[model samples]
Target: MKTPNPARRSERSRRAILSAAFDLVAEAGYAKLTVEAIAARAGVGKQTIYRWWPSKGAVFVDAVLSLSEDDTGGLSLPDTGDLRADLSGVLRAIVDEYNDPRLDAMSRALTAESLADPTLNSEITARILGPLLEVTKDRLRSAQRAGQVAADADLSVAVELLYGPIYHRWMLRTHPLTHEYADTVVEFALRALEPAH
Candidate 1:
């Protein structure tokens, strides 16, 4: 029998740990998630998790990322030249993902846990929210280069405009998030971002 490659075995262990973390959070919530529990579920030693991550929050963020992987390997904002359509596509996808029972449960649990714990919040911001905002910033910068966005437009504000409404609606549960709403948000945001004559 061929000897197992160390790299492949490590990768398998890592994916297993991520899967276990996602499943645990989806079932028991992040508040109850512990390194020991993740190790037990992943069938690895606690030291293995500690060797790979400094904290459970890091593992949680990694799990969240792994769970959200797509054809491109992970979720990323699109840059299709049509700013409105690209933003709409991302927001619509977010809505669809949030509608999944397991994803919804884990996402909400993470939000709550982050709110209650500053360290977890920092980890999540660095790993999850930071990358997402960067993708939006990159897309806006591309649009600006193409003369599709105003030169003076604040990219940070633009990012907020694109994602804030969807997040607000999702968090408050005040209304259903639909593809139509995503498109509407894009139209409204693009109107504000359009270059002046």
Candidate 2:
């Protein structure tokens, strides 16, 4: 008999689990999410998820990343030459995701959970924010190399500046998120980081 392709089955299981996690979180919020529920929705045993992830938070974060497909394999900065337009386009895409109600619900749930669970807060960053920040920081370092950003720019801080305003509005509900707002944030944030000459 031909040896069954275990990798293919594993991939299918992973996709189902992630899709179930995302749908459940978007529908019920993080506070109510459980591994059991995900297993039920995924049509897999709870052991399947545990084998792949350590906790529900990890699963949820992975699920969100899967749904968002943020392209984390490398620093995904567009290099069409204009830093402003490139950054604006990146941030605008982020803003567009925020505009989606499913993502909005999931983000809100993740944010709320982070507030009450210090460990989870750290977990959230480790699973989601850490990779994203590193990629963006790498992108900023590329800009520095290209003379689009100041040589001495603190890339961590610059990356934060790019995301912080958008995160604030998204988390606090202080204002409507829009492409205009994201572009404005990119403009203002880059002003301080741009080459001094």
Candidate 3:
């Protein structure tokens, strides 16, 4: 029987700590979550967590990234040549996930933390949100190539238009995030992007 390498064991411990941190936040909210709690839940020592993550905020961000991977299944957007349908499908899926209890908890916690700390805000945006937005832009660019969207359509603006409203609704709790809302967003966005007569 060969002994496990120390480096591999350390890496596994780190992953476990991050996963446990996310689960704790999802269940108990970030305010009640602590490094000691995560260490115990992860079956690792408290020093181990402190050695890697500088603060609970860093651990929370890592956990959020992990949860996002589970949610998005790795960020390749759906592009079936029909711009409106593709955008609608993607956005609706996002809305559904955003409304889920686990995701909502994590999102709210992160939002609160971001509001308090500019560094955390920048880290989350750069690590989690930016890549997702880039994926959206890539899909819209594909639509442009297929002529479903006008050549001059601003992909960045289009992506923002598609996702901004959904985020607004989620953050504000203004209305139910339904497929119907997604459909309306797609319709208005597509019309706006259509070539001028």
Candidate closest to the true structure, highest TM-score: 1
Model 2 regions lying over 4 Å from their true place: 1-4, 68-76
Across 1-197, the per-residue lDDT of candidate 1 in tens digits comes to: 89979999999999999999888887889999999999999999999999999998889888877765642215567787887778887888888877877777777888888899999999878777778888888999999999999999999999999889889998999998888888899999999999997
| lDDT of each residue in 1-197, candidate 3, tens digit only | 99879999998998899889888888877777899999999999999999988888788778776755533434457777777777888888888778778787778886896898787788788877788888887887777777777899888888888888988988899999999998999899888887666
lDDT of 2 by residue, 1-197 (tens): 88889999999999999999888877888888899999999999999999999998888777766755464422256767677887887788778778988767667777888999787798768867788777678778788899889999888789889999998888888999999898899989889898998
Off by over 4 Å in 3: 68-75
Per-prediction backbone clash count: 0, 0, 0
Error of 1 at 57 (Å): 0.8
Candidate 3 local distance difference test against the native: 0.82
The collision pairs in model 2 are none
> Candidate 1: deviation at residue 115, Å?
0.7
Please list all clashing residue pairs in model 3, or write none if there are none.
Answer: none
Query: What TM-score does candidate 2 reach?
Result: 0.87
Superior by lDDT: candidate 1 or candidate 2 = 1
lDDT of each: 0.86, 0.82, 0.82
lDDT of 3 at 111: 86
